[model samples]
Target: MAMMQKTEILIIGAGVIGICAAYYLTEKGYKVTVVDKGEVCSGCSYGNVGVAVPSICGTLASPGIISKSLKWLLDPESPFYIKPRFNRDLIGWLWEFQRACNEPQMRRGLSILHEFNTASVELFKDLAAQEKMDFGFVQKGLLVVFKSLPGFKEGVQEAELRQKIGIEAEIIRGSELRSFAPHLRSGLAGGIYYRRDAHLDPYKFVRRLAEKTRKKGAQILTSTEVIGFEIFGKAIKTVETTRGDFTADEVVLAAGAWSSEMSRYLGLKLPIQAAKGYSITYRLPENYLEMPVSLSETKVFITPLADTLRLGGTLELAGMDLSINKRRVNAILKTVPEYIDINIENLKLIEIWRGLRPCTPDGLPFLGRCRAINNFIVAAGHAMEGISLGPVTGQLVAQVIGNEKPSVDLSLMSIERFN
Candidate 1:
């Protein structure tokens, strides 16, 4: 066996969570090493609708989503679809997800998510200001446009609920919608404007952060796949990877959708499922979208990047597959012309990307120490909010490793919450 390399802190998975954790830990003067099966930000962190929305408090497991998912199941082009499978884990997760849809659980999940998202967005702003890492971060806010009265009514109710919970939201209708967002197509019923929301170029953000971390003396080993771990008593003593064995005083598992498989080495059952999503980037049109807009009725998010525009939506519960679904892509493309003055046929495709988001049954991320392994921390399960919550998750990981109190309550993020 080759002699194991050593570091003060070792992070698995070089996606948003792992990279952010590495950056923060390196800043804290820790000898950090980040290893991933693929290159940095090459996974779910890239190619997402880069909207930094802190005003969204509702979980994906919220009420009505189950019914919505059922209706979507029959349509291949639906915004959310679940492949029929006999996997026990998927079955268990669905049941728990269904149970978590009630008022009490939704409120509890939203409370934690709301606080984390608010703090994370501020942290992102601070990172941009302090580091001058320009990833086209914009704070122009997000517009959720509804074409039908029913959807518009739901938007109003959601806006009111968000307002009650200290989130900045406003309902814009008719003339105001036209004047405020002249870029949008005519005949929209109404829309909800979340003033606290923002958008950015996610690809640039992740690559830049990785570069910055390397400059600060953090070791990032891409294509280094972790295969096993050496556990002693209640702690991980060493991690065995395809490259070589490595030893770290502290280990963090932020492997996103792959964490469930990795956790087995430590005798842990992490109830995480891979929710597949797709995004298509196009060269900016002559009249590109001025800001981030979510087609509320279709569930597609249109985000304006520097030189391109991205349209992304759809959540498929079809375990770790990167294959593109043309129907889902078409569904997203079809929604564009209804809300805006863009013809899908005329757009030039820059890229088509698909990624699997790590999702927990309850819609809350698993953050903090593992019960079976004292030195190991799990920070996966952010689902669609990985980019939005990256920095704060990193900050929390650093605080946990430094033996300092976390900025927010860690009870909700407990790894053993399912147990």
Candidate 2:
């Protein structure tokens, strides 16, 4: 261990949340340092569907989650499949998820998500423009298409719930949906359109944000592992990292999938499991420059990037592991045929990535001061929303350190909810 250095605020996990936190804090005139174990933005924050979906306010464990599991459990390639791994934590997490899937819990969970996500949408747009970051942000919105009429009807009902909360949703017929973005194959039923949501190139988004933060004088130290923390009387004294020991007035734990281990080191019991997801990008064949679209029936998200069509979707409830499962990757490829007539055999796979989504039992992130210790705050367990919620999470973190009002009510997302 090296000798101790000092910072006004220290952030672990240099992904979107950590980077964003550093940016906001530094603007508030605080000395900040950000550290990460691996390459920055290589986690789930970098490679998701890339949708800032304020419209998707439902909990990960919804009313039909238990019922849906029955049909998906047998299919290895199902959207929500659980492996037969004999892991106690994974089993316990599933149980916790089931408990939260009740009717009342669904309403409560989605309501909370709605507020945070909506606030994040506005915040992210503001940051991108003011910071001059070209994150490929387009407010063209997302169109979810389906092949089954029943699925379309159900999706409309779900969109109705979003509209009730002031989210704009246009229930379009198959022809109308395709007309607005004519790229998918035929036989598409109707789907709900969330005009308020937006999408972006996640890779560009993170990189540009980090670049802008660095320009604004936020030091992002990559490959710096936080070995352990120093706490005294409910305040974080120092964070011991591989590079050096740094003392700070406050610290934010934004380590994503690796957050569970960090929480254990801090003596906090945060039940977060690493759910792995895979994405494959294919170069555009021709004239596919339309807005990104998601296939509702297959749970596949195909977003159009600057020069390629990136198709990614699949949630594997694995541990803190990163071994790429060939089957899961293939499952994502299988959805391509259902959506569009891509040149599958000839298309090049620009990348094959597997990042862990730091998932909680109820699909809500823990964001607040650690009750056990005041100086230690948590901003992890974001799961699939790490990128989408990064800006808002960062702003809220700065607010806490500044002793200001938060943008949204964080009662449900508080770390105390776990206790």
Best prediction by lDDT: 1
Per-residue lDDT of 331-378 in model 1, one digit per residue for the tens? Answer: 888888898877778889999889898999888899998766889998
Q: What is the C-alpha RMSD of each candidate to the true structure, in Å?
A: 1.1, 1.6
* lDDT, candidates in the order shown: 0.88, 0.81
CA lDDT, candidate 1, residue 345: 80
Clashing pairs in 2: none
Candidate no. 2 TM-score: 0.96
Give the least accurate 10-residue stretch of model 2, judged by summed lDDT.
177-186
lDDT of 2 at 346: 86
Displacement of residue 173 (Cα, Å) in model 1 is 1.2
Residue 78 accuracy (lDDT) in model 2: 83
Model 1 stretches with alpha carbons more than 4 Å out: none
lDDT of 2 by residue, 1-419 (tens): 56688778889988888888888888888888888887778778776768877776566888887887788888888877676788877787888888888878887777777777888888878977787778888887777887889999889888887777787888888877567666667777887777777888877877887787777787889888999987788877878888988988888899988888898888877889888888887787678745667788778888877787778887777677789888878987878777676667788778878788889999999888878888888898887777778888999999988889887887778886756
